[model samples]
Target: MATARKYNVEAVFKGAPKKSDFKIVEETLPAIKDGEFLAEAIWLSVDPYMRLFVNSSNVGNTMFGEQVAKVIESKNENFKVGDYVAGMFGWRTKTISNGDQVRKLDRSVYTDDKLSTGLGILGMPGATAYIAFLSICAPKEGETLVVTGAAGVVGSAVGQIAKIKGCRVVGFAGSDEKVQYLKSLGFDEAINYKTMTSLKETLEKTCPKGIDMFFDNVGGEFYDTIIPQMNTSGRVAVVGCISQYNLENPEKGPRLNPSILAKELTIKGFVIYNHLPRWPEAFKAIGEWIEKGQLKYNETVTEGFDNMFDAFSGLFTGKNTGKAVVKA
Candidate 1:
């Protein structure tokens, strides 16, 4: 038997997550049996959706999330030793899996053979941005597109892709630092919603003509405000609503009743899992962009598996840039 460390929830989050809410417990793993493989965790991801999903996460159960792990030993011929894969393996240092659905990552994304990226840019968030922007937004040259939560993995990718498609890109973020980061990625305008003008005022000033597309990551009031600023026949990809994730009995934002009719908007709410069959398409496109200096990405790495709660808390307060990863 081998001892494995895992973080489990002791209590559900009340508002913002607290360190006292989680506990680290040691569990012994049985030897790998037939059709089973053992993987050691390399990196774990902290995402906004995880915050939203806890409404149903069983108290005292292992926290639910994804990770990049290397198959250390295997009885399954499909998952051989030294092969890296990503899966929804929860928060554990070692995983005993049947080698179900997992994808191999290209080391070109992050050299040193570290498997962290399978959880971040090269993983779910990357796929989310790719499918939604190209399939939903379908930005055209000179069309104006605005992205909310522009500093995170999906938002950053959305802005860059809009730029690649020759769309004029505008971004709204929580902090000035993130605003600067969005500008560096070639966004035409990056507005800090915290101190700057209201979303409607900023939209009026920055994109006076009206928005042709919107890649929405922060919903609630932000969504309500953005709806009226859209041009006729505009498209919106509602990827995630991170702003409302942490609130206790969250209040609804402004009503979007008249704006949808007025703007004739196409709002599509989606999950990236539906586009897994087309991942290679997205991977190839994003890979080329990274190779050609067109797409810029950043990861905020927090070292130590013991600090998972701290890393997760960072996402709620906009403490990270681009993608947030925890190095085990």
Candidate 2:
């Protein structure tokens, strides 16, 4: 019999997840029966959404999330002993993924590319940024688009993809370094939201006229500040809200959303899962962009699988300069 070590949730999140909320437990695996394959987790993903997704899931269950794994042994014909797979394998060192049990992943996305990227730029966050901003916001060339959380994975991708669309990108990030990073990625302006609370004044200086679109990665006050500055008929793609994720009780939002009605703003909320059909399209473009130097990505890697929780929690505090990941 083979044994697997896994992390089972011992406590539920009260607010922002504390390290004490998780516990490690081990399990012995039954021998693989017909039709089942055993996979080993090679790379695990941690994102801001986990802060919210874990709230309803019960304690004593496997932690939720996806991983890129190697098929170390198998009985299923579709997956051989050496195939690489990406699936919702939870926070475990090993998983049983039959063809029926597996989440589909195309190796073309991560083979020539870095495996960790399948969890970041080439993975979920990549698909999120590509389809949400392009299809929903529909930025046109010379249009000014504003994005918050510019330094994080999804935010960084949104800004860069907007640049590829020939739009003038104004990015907001937590620190001066992230601001500079956005500028280096060819943003027209990068605002350090921490240094200046006067978002309206900053918009006036950066836009001169007004913003045509907003790729909102952080909701709360960030979007509220930018809402009134939008050009008429502007589109906004509501992505993840990291700023409010950790708060046990997210504060009451300012009443600025009402202005959208008067302003005739077009706002849409989306998840990448809804756009899975376009995975191939996103991979081709993002992969080519990387090869041609039209796009770039940075990762904040914390060493060891043991540090996963710390790396995940760091996403909220601006502790990471770019897409945060754990290196096993």
Instruction: Identify the leading candidate in terms of TM-score.
Output: 1
Cα-lDDT of candidate 1: 0.86
Which ranges of candidate 1 are over 4 A from the true structure? 106-114
Per-prediction CA RMSD (Å) = 1.5, 1.7
Residue-level error in angstroms, candidate 1, position 243: 1.0
Q: lDDT per residue, candidate 2, 1-328, as tens digits?
A: 6777777787878777888888877888888877888988788888888777774455889888888888887888888887877788888888887666365456665674488888888888888888898998998888999898888888888889998989988889888888888888888899899998688888999998798899998888878788888888899999878778767676886676667887889999998887888976887888899989999999998887788888888877889876787766
lDDT of model 1 at position 307? 85
| Candidate 2 structure, TM-score to reference | 0.95
Residues 193-265, candidate 1, lDDT per residue (tens digit)? 9998566778999997799998999888878888888899999999988888877897867778688888788
What's the lDDT of the predicted structure labeled candidate 2?
0.83
Q: Which ten residues in a row have the lowest lDDT in candidate 2?
A: 100-109
Name the top lDDT candidate: 1
